[model samples]
Target: MDSPATLEHYKAGMLLSGAGDSTGFKRELNYSGPDIHEAKKQLGGLKNITVKLPDWSVSDDTDLHLATAEALATGKKGEELLQEVALHYVEGMKDMTGREPGGSTIMGASMLKPGTEGGYRIPYNPESGGCGAAMRTMFIGLSPATLEHYKAGMLLSGAGDAIGFKWEFNYSGPDIHEAVKQLGGLKNITVKLPDWSVSDDTVLHLATAEALATGKKGEELLQEVAFRYVEGMKDMTGREPGGSTIMGASMLKPGTEGGYRIPYNPRSGGCGAAMRTMCIGLRYPRPEQLSSLVAVAVETGRMTHPHPTGFLGGLASALFTAYAVQRRPITEWGLGLVKEACPAAKEFVKTAGYAVEETERDWGYFTEKWEWYLELRGLSSGTGPVVWPDPYGPAERDKAYESFSWSGWGGSSGHDAPMIALDALLGAGSNWEELMNRVAFHGGDSDSTAVIACCCWGLLYGTEGVPPGNYSNLEYRDRLENSAEELYKLSH
Candidate 1:
């Protein structure tokens, strides 16, 4: 290893700053997160380690301890023969996301296939909600390398959800490809958008409108537009923030017991709003609007979540992401950003001593007990009808929140959801072996968490789809390209 100096390898580039306290607004905050400096030290020792490729692993030397172990394998860096792992990534989950199977939610999984004509198709079914929109948003960072492209990306991801499939398959399904074609805004293109691609009327039209209005309103453009567009999520069925959204955060109104400066999260928090955060790059200026994302998203959280922890949960997620990419592997890094970002996220949650799991996967188990913790233990029924219940005070018998609740965590939903998302990306580990150890036991929404895991894994790999069996999904290629393009534009 070399000296202990720190090196920040960003995907594109991002600023790391401590978001200011509830006071004067500071445009650019450079916060590296707690223990981040120490994390850098661990990274220093990492260079000395050599990653051995498995005979069959997704990313060399699969983190075999946890996951079921994929058949794919990778080779040494700089080797001309390193297996193309990113390709299969998009392949495995495409069709699984359809309404019939994957249906109506990003929390569902989809399968990807390669073919002629249009390279990709929705294959599975259409899903609604900001989570699907957000998870599929990788392309957003790709095509849109500028303000203009960012708008287009947002339109496609968010607005696409307005449509409904099933029963009216032809009208709804066929239009999905058309929506992508238009929202991709790739006019006069011989490359037809192909067929079978799933999209929604809400995301399509809303994104289209945003594309048109981008830059028209100056700085606050994205904030206003994305906020407007995200409202579409309010209509998506089965979508609601879990109660853990406010379980243990500081900002819990006042007299909060057990050490709460604030309840950190509010009951209204869900993967939905954070999913909407991806499109934000298109709407807001970084470093500048970053804090606003935390602040305004909180107001939005209050809509359904009476608890502040829910708000903090979303806030922490976005902030950590905007901050943690500073250390992604540029030379030969692991797909650890998801892992790093989640724990780093606790810096915000720590305000409430919300309890950060040993790792992101542990959150899976903690989440299992989530609803049990909230309704039975956290929420007290005595005080009737709290719009936003503060989980502080004497473990209270009050209900400043019972009536105004958005929805319950239902235990089942939260448990499986995050992990499914994890599997979707599959990058939880430094290698395949590690990936398994981290994801397989993931509680609650196994399928959905896997979906997200795969998606996040795909993020580390950028536009590359998972290899062989899944890669050539033509439709996947197109959408992946489109999504990446959109994200690229927003970064600048």
Candidate 2:
């Protein structure tokens, strides 16, 4: 594993670079000719002068640092690096307060303009050797290999979800039978047993991968792709899709006026929403893009779960997954990101007619309840007691489960399942087997929680960390691998 300190140092260095730029510009303001000095002198020799500071924001140096970091994280190199940096550079300029960048930085960035015919060349300006470029190169010192490893880890997570679903819940429904029939008979299956089959989670993930591969923007495209998958599932199996799929399929049905905005069941808050959000998180690379990411996640969730809790559950899952894939220190920043994304989640929930008072209280209560549950589970941070003395042995777990649902099926609720999955991931530490075991055996929607938890485990540790036995028996193993590869390609 790469040292967290090293990542933190690079982050701190970038911030320091920005601070240096701010200080340098501010100091220069202090020496703005004798006329300014005279004007200050006329103000009664005020030694303690308060001047309105310039924006004091980071400059193109920080901009280049961020862009380069993203490029490196996504495995861009040579011409790819140049193109990515060029695009990010323009985006950085547009993001700037006044749409201006340092002349040298702009010149170097402009060399890789769109439609420019270039094989591969260093984007440097001989005329300009400003400190901007040199100072921001600290991030480049971090190994690209580490980022690649993280990507592999994320893909493995997707695999874990799909395969884990198969291993734990075998095929019992018409959906599984149809899938098996479509892919030759059980006799043709070599690695997979007849009973092993994937769920809507994997199907929806592949749907997302196909959509992203076509270069479509997230929101509408992802939702459409998800609906198509749901519709396909409905067509294949002459049964109403269970859990959140029922609501999603209903919403996707042609409405009274030839539209797709049919009202869905707001009461549905199943784990399905969170289970399928990993693909969305993998597509968008930055936190600044969180709003759009959350938007798409909500739309995807709206297919089945229009409730605020449902949307927030999906958003939270994607945020955590994205942060994990980016190699953010989970123990340090995971909970913080969840908290940061909560306001947006609440607002999304509010749109579902969740009372304002209830929205605020629910989020606050959920956080508190989650923390309390973690404490009870003997988890201090992202690591904890490896083997929880069977949760069923103690009445406390039963009571907690009942608090969420009367049927002891807490994992059926979108909010509850994600919380449980997050808890499982945090407490599992590096023990992938333990994570899988705990989630799979937790009972009541265990399959859903297993998928979510296993996905998180994969994000933290690559496929190498997962036991081969877990995925080897999956019927759609090849498809899962292909989907993961496609998602990885598009993400990069």
Candidate 3:
């Protein structure tokens, strides 16, 4: 190789320390309503702790977090959110080079390898799909790299897959363009992703609509645009739905691909699509401009879920991030107000009293073949499939391993890494317990996650957030930082 390929990642801790000003830190708000009340009741009345929105403001121009936080704080729409994200990127992350790997077999089985080392350097895996990028690269639409360029990056993400985890939070332009075509390009197009892959039809469609609505052209200030395309499709094709989420976005589609899958249940709540929603508001103008964005997001989602549970969930996240950027506390009013705006999240609001009754619950819970009560008593994870070091074991580094499993797909590295790697790209806090921990838990994919997470957190917090350059190499980190700034400019 021409000088040992470089590694990549996001830096969570650093952003916390640097960026913007220290005065930006705000206080936590009073926990209102039954949700906090329930948590307090469950925790034996220990309610309200010092929970301030994470310190630091994204770049000034169009801080996604700030814009999103403002929109949510003041009430806004999904289209506005879209406008905010795309508009900022005209310059924000123009140089960003990691998240969109252009060519490879995706993260799983789809990737191929050249067999020229002594014989075959490694065995070929053909199972995983690059769904992680959809989540980790939460800022892609506004991160420069056009739809066409992003796909090329995605294919290359898993480029080094043959040796170890090679995927990073890079964009794949051409491939993304193709995926868009398959997933229905902007305007009145109809398409879909490969059998196992997901085309960003929903992402692009809404973004496109926002652009068309606002008459924002050339992608200079996309967030300021509208969602006419998304709105247009609402009547005919239906709103964009989450890919195999809780409601069953996978219920049915133009093809038989969705029908064949099992119940459309995503194993996560770890901010998968929520992050995407946040980016929209993040890019929107001010809080007053959020209504359309919020409406579009919720309306688009309703095609598959009339219930609005997820619609509100997405709103909560997007607006919460928006509110967060303003240094506002995550108030009961804030949480309550979200549902008021959309009134959909209330569906999951558990009004009934709750109890935690479990016998000798331990490890291997998810793998257990026990009955209802037994399994409930012992589950690898409850209500969600979490990804992390054994939370129930001797290595009790709970803080060390942030939960990256947003979609309930975790356990072994070999079978479940690509997705994990995606999470690592956006995850905050410490690194893997050890190198072995990184690879052992998720193997090749694990390090990629850790590395990528470092960069994102780094942007949010700064360089100090990282654990040395253990995961990130020189070339990659530089590329990420420059890109992050460019994206920050685009957002501004």
Candidate 4:
């Protein structure tokens, strides 16, 4: 049997690999097979060729190989190891000027992040057939295997909540921007204690998050969530919660008969349900669990919202987060959720024994609203490709917000909250400032949209680009991060 590679053998292998890479780079770029043979004959032999720096430096393959080796040498394993490798890969970019790095490798490195259940893996790219990964993975084969995972969004979500809450009472539209300008922009607006506190949006979102982190399932989980909601209401004294939320929490009572629930509320089509349901996605984030996510989100949503508008908003928030965990494209998340979740939401409502006629009417309204909004982006029927770029400028976003407005508030209704959040997320891409500008510094229900948008953004990108001070002193940061970690653990 072949013996394992020793230290000396590994060193020799690495040198040999670098030398081979350098040789291949020169040969491929300079000559074809017969031409190279003629050159070899002219030079007396192939061994006569001298491969050295300046004339023949190693390519990106060898650079990445050394990066992988350096990361492994740090002795980090699993998720941390992956992150370290990604870090090294990014750091290695400075040396890649003449190396001609592969496009896929560059893209993967640029996009890679730490502390997710998805690990260091990038989304599937069908056209990424190259030897970049193979060349760099040699050191990975030499290292001992291990696993670890973790999230940073819960803290950032709270940061968004607190920051948005500051503008909730007296600011909207142009006034919100004026306030931000007065405060020297979002970057200078630090998120700290009493000055910047979370509203009821975060209180109830925490309630839902805490319940999900308990690792319970089925009816018992629902019961736990209901209990937390009731308890959460008691803490909303200065938090300025919504009327529907207060009413719903007051009505929630524990019993052995099919968990806590309330009848449909025609007037409760507000963002109350949507703001706090993203945690459901963290708990049941698998693609196969989409139905369960719908059922749970619908049930929890009805505990307060009851109407199709309210419950469906909750479903959208949760489903988007689930899609984020799966690394699905943001363009697909909105329409994708509507198509996959609407039927399940309807089935859940019917199974719970709602009036058939009323149910049909509500479902129709909910489905029609989503269709209208999705169509605005040319995602007609929830199955078409996205044909419009989401708006980023204040005027454009304001126009979009006006289109989503209902009951005089831009994102006041449950449906529009998710709509606005999704639009903001779609436009923001990896830009954190853009996300805050579009979602938080908005006209209506700023905190509601902020909570959902920030959570989904956190899941997809973590807090990589965010300023640390913005989230460092956030209230309830420990709780938020703990819940995020628990959910991340459970997700993996």
Judged by lDDT, which candidate is best? Answer: 4
The total of clashing pairs for model 3 equals 131
Q: Compared with the true structure, what per-residue lDDT tens digits does model 2 show for residues 302-335?
A: 5666655665667766776667666665553335
RMSD of each: 22.0, 13.6, 23.4, 11.7
Ten contiguous residues with the weakest lDDT in model 4: 142-151
Query: Please, what are the lDDT tens digits per residue for candidate 3 over residues 1-492?
Result: 011111122233233322322222221133456565665566465333333344222222223333333334333345554444333332233422322322222232122122222221225535434332232233232322222222112121211121122211112223323443463432222112111111222232233323433433222332232223233233322322333332333342322322212221223222223322433433332355455446544433332322223233345434443343332322221322323433322222222111101101211221121122113223222222324444433123222222322233231121122223323322223332222233223312222333222222322333322233222332222332333333334434
TM-score for predicted model 3 compared with the true structure: 0.29
lDDT of 1 by residue, 19-64 (tens): 1111101101336544554554565743432333231112100111
Ordered by TM-score, highest first, the candidates read 4, 2, 1, 3
Residue-wise C-alpha lDDT for candidate 4, range 152-258, written one tens digit per residue: 55676788889888877643567888888998988887888779888898899899999988998888988999999999988886789998988988888866565
- Please report, as a residue range, the 10-residue window in candidate 1 with the lowest summed lDDT: 18-27
Error of 3 at 478 (Å): 12
Question: Can you give the lDDT of residue 367 in candidate 4?
Answer: 71
Clashes of 2: 4
Please give the distance, in angstroms, between residue 380's alpha carbon in candidate 2 and its true position after superposition.
Answer: 10
- How far in Å is the alpha carbon of 466 misplaced in model 3? 3.4
Scored by lDDT, model 3 comes in at 0.29
Better of 2 and 4 by TM-score: 4
Angstrom error of the Cα, residue 144, model 2: value is 7.3
Residue 285 accuracy (lDDT) in model 4: 75
